[model samples]
Target: MNQKHLLACHERILPYIHRTPVLTSRWINERAGTEVFFKCENFQRGGAYKARGATNAVLQLTDTQKKNGVVTHSSGNFAQALSIAAKNVGAKAFIVMPLTAPKVKKDAVKAYGGNIIECEPTLKAREAMAEKIVREKEATFIHPSNDEQVIMGQGTACMELLEERPGLSAILIPVGGGGLAAGTSLAAYFFGTHCEVWGAEPFSVDDAYRSFKSGKIESNASTETIADGLRTQLGDRSFPIMKKYMKGIIRVEEAEIVETMRFVWERMKIIIEPSSAVALAAVFREKDKFRNKHIGVIISGGNVDLNNLPF
Candidate 1:
């Protein structure tokens, strides 16, 4: 998509989503040796930035499409987002979720009015189930991260960030299926004065990093990352945008992810998910690069299972 698309998306989804605040921590700045601003999407509607994309995609649907409803396969944030977005517009949402997904997430989806269809905890199964629902229900499919409208909607988070902190030198976002990373990159390119965009990925599931270096889409052989929200692979739509706009991807270890998550909780007193911590861990991993510079970090979500916290 282009700048105009992103701007329109921000306006279209404004009423449906929250303009989450940008927060900062003096201690965090000292620890990283950089001035850091955090765009807390953890505080966003549905407890994640996925709300922006979901709301945008749902709102753009025609009456017939809305009547037919929307269907998507998501294990977490996007499931809740799509359900809530559909409910707000008086539409039905059929969500295909893995049986292995956290109970809390599934509950959230149900609470938001989604009709959950359980599938095997595999991408193939999830996709098959979603496709079947689309055929039988004649529903529209709204991809969590790969759709152009979703990408533009996700960019609005960074657009808001830039509007509040125009002088940011750079922004770091966690890359999963590459929605937020791609969106943030576009936002920085269009809105920032000279802001650079970077991505943080788990070494356990470093498909985005591998894809960036190899100049093609890459798949993960294993999804063994604690940053559950970041286990997905990049799609055709988001990959090209991120490849063209992102500066680079920094991979962090599982331990680093947990440590950063705990650090943010204890120090910033904010409950951020491991996926969100990935971006901050990247900053700590390469502290020298961002030293004395103004950096904006996107906290992607806060839908963590408290009972299973690593720290």
Candidate 2:
């Protein structure tokens, strides 16, 4: 995707989405051994960075396309985002979610007026179901990742971070499908911000990390992390962008992820879900490396199920 295209999308989306805050914690800074600035995407519309991309994709659609409605397959947050975006654009949203996705996400999609379709938690299965729905209902498909407009929209989070902290040393984002990582990294690269962007992933499902290391695509065993949003295999389109612009991909253990979640909850008094905590875990797991740097980390989402504790 062109940087100009994404830059324009940011301008179009600013009036629609929240300019979520960058919260700094003195204690987190001490623990990470860095000046830690947290871009709390947990505070975003639909409770994630997904909103920016989803809104942009919907906004790009014409009135004729809006009348046809929109369809997408997501683990959770993306569905809620597309549903809310679709609602804003006066279009119907048909969202296909895995049976294993969290209830909080499913409920949020419904609240935003999306029609939910249940599917197995595999991307192949989700795509199949989404296509079937699209064919039957004559709805326009809005991919959760891999679409240029969507990726540009996802880049807005990075734009916001750079705009807020122009001198950031690096940015750490939780990687799932790679849209956020790829898009955000490009934004940093284009702005000449001298910021190294990194992707954080759960070791349990680290296809993106393996892809980065092997210089090719790699799919791990079936989904295994409590962070449902990080299940996807990185896109062919996204892999090149990530490899070119992202500094690196880091994988953290499931235990580390849970520990980070607990720490953020207890200290930040913020309800960040497991996926958002991965970036924080990345820094804590490698405290020696971040000794005196200024790091920006995006907490990708906060729609957690209070009843389910991964620890």
Q: Which candidate is the best by lDDT?
A: 1
Question: lDDT for each of the candidates?
Answer: 0.93, 0.88
Question: What's the TM-score of every candidate structure?
Answer: 0.99, 0.97
| Full-model lDDT, candidate 1 | 0.93
In model 1, the runs with Cα more than 4 Å from the true position are none
For model 2, residues 148-213, the per-residue Cα lDDT tens digits are: 788888888888888888998888999998889888888888764688998899989989988988
With a 3 Å backbone cut-off (N, CA, C), the pairs that clash in candidate 2 are none
Cα RMSD for candidates in order: 0.7, 1.2
Clashes of each: 0, 0
Model 2 residue runs over 4 Å out of place are: none
Report clash pairs, candidate 1: none
Tally clashing residue pairs in candidate 2: 0
